[model samples]
Target: MSVARKVVIEITSDNVCPWCYIGKKRLDKAIARAPSNLSFDVRFRPFQLDPTASPYGVPKLEAYERKFGADRVEKMIPHMKAVGEAEGIKFDYGGLIANTLDSHRLLAFAASQNKQLPVSAALFAAYFENQQNIGDRETLIEIAAKAGLDADAARAYIESDAGEREVREEVAGARQRGISGVPFFRIDGLYEISGAQDPAVFEEVFAKIAESA
Candidate 1:
């Protein structure tokens, strides 16, 4: 038997993005289907879908309509909902506009504690499923605690300007790389996959990486 190949996958996404959540689920399924000889070190990177969003946020539906127009928003909803349902996610696109900066900062803090993935999932669920305002400090602290981080530490981190600069710089770097969209995946620092691609696409990429290894 050959040695298992280790691959690093860095996913640049925003918590408020429904497609990112779906992409995450598909990526998980693809990883689960990988051969035993393949190992993954997956990391979540920050990308702001709306950098100009207010910290207080606006109504989700209103924001969507304002940004994408009512007609397009109406057409996009059923599609997003269908895709989310297929991925076993119930996306409740209720009226809760979220400023994802604080959430991204929390993710950065979670990365320090090696809890990035769980915290990110919690944030996504809170925003999309539970309709919780992830922009709120209290909600974020609660989500962080639920993800196994120290609540007090998380609160303190949020109160302070701890992860702000890092998150901003990471977002800037992503933009500098010409990445204007969320759910962008960089595999083994070589291959790039954008949007909520199919599991077969992810599987094919993984297989190619494994074979090359």
Candidate 2:
């Protein structure tokens, strides 16, 4: 019997993106249904939804009102809530809106320790569920610790310039590739799947790729 082919999937996403969170959940479900004759290596890449957002952050409603206007944001709330519920995410967008660069940096640090996914999930929950300020160093350190990373090391890593350059370059590279959105998936560095597609969509794509391999 032929050995299962190894597939690498790199996900470019931002913690601030609601669709990214949903996409991650859907991807997890799809992977669970993948054929037995396949192996997977999944990595999370960085993307900044708002690079210039203040480090101190702003009230969620205020930020939303300023950027997308009150009426549009208001209309989006129910839809966002509905989608999040379907994905088993109880999104509470009552937190502050801050720069996610630091969060991205923490994720890079987590990647080094092979704790990226947990850290990423924590950040998402902290921001969307617990409504915490993820841009704060202390908050990030705490989240990192909860994800099995050393608190002191995570703090030092976020405080220093360790992962800043790499994160910036990755975001820039995404832009260069004409990727203007989050939750973008690249399979085997060849096939591209954009947005928060359905699990069946991901499963079908995985099947086709595995067959071709």
Candidate 3:
């Protein structure tokens, strides 16, 4: 029997990033294609693409256009749409907004419990699919429950100050590492994949790690 490989992949992302969604989808597809003997672990770290963003949410396209220039934003739309279509995901650009600090906290809590991957995926679905506010406590609890977590405990964690420091620390660490964008995937804590890349990229990385292990 093959020994289950121990691989730790970390991602620093926020809920509102369009490319982050695409990155996740691509990673999921890559993982699905990975060898069955390859067992690994994944964690979601904290990084606010816009740490200064208001809790009420800034305009999605407008914000991107302003930050990266209107021309670049205009160019990004078609690419983003294509990626979403490839992954069978709908790009709800208009519906994307929110601070995501609370979401980060919940992720940290889930990470502490070794449930970060599923919880983070569920939180993304809640925001992008269900058009729900991931920052809302009730919404987070529901999402956590859907991810196989305890809704009541998630609710309590959101209500309490628990895991806030860890979330902040993760954000600070990302900043210290010079991460300014979402969907930054760190493979085996060494190889870094940034933005919404093709599944082939993740496949290559996953294969390399599996071989190394």
What TM-score, computed on C-alpha atoms, does each candidate reach?
0.96, 0.96, 0.86
Q: Let me know the TM-score candidate 2 reaches against the reference structure.
A: 0.96
lDDT of 2 by residue, 27-103 (tens): 99999999888888888999988899999999998998998999999999999999999999998978797999999
Tens-digit lDDT string for candidate 1 (1-213):
777899999999998988899999999999999977899988999999888898887889999999899999999999988888899998887757767899999999999999998998999899999989999899999999999999999999998999899899999999999999989999998999999999999999988887777
What order do you get sorting by lDDT, best first? 1, 2, 3
Q: Clashes in candidate 3: how many?
A: 0
Q: Candidate 1: what lDDT?
A: 0.91
What are the clash counts of all predictions, listed in order? 0, 0, 0
Select the stronger candidate by lDDT from 1 and 3: 1
Clashes of 1: 0
Looking at candidate 3, the ten consecutive residues that score lowest on lDDT are 89-98
RMSD of 1: 1.2
lDDT of 1 at 38: 90
Q: Candidate 3 lDDT, tens digit per residue, 1-213? A: 768777777878887776787788888888889866576677777888766777666666676787889999889888877777888877666654668888888888887777888887787777766667776677788888889888888888899988777777888888898887888999877899988889999889888877777
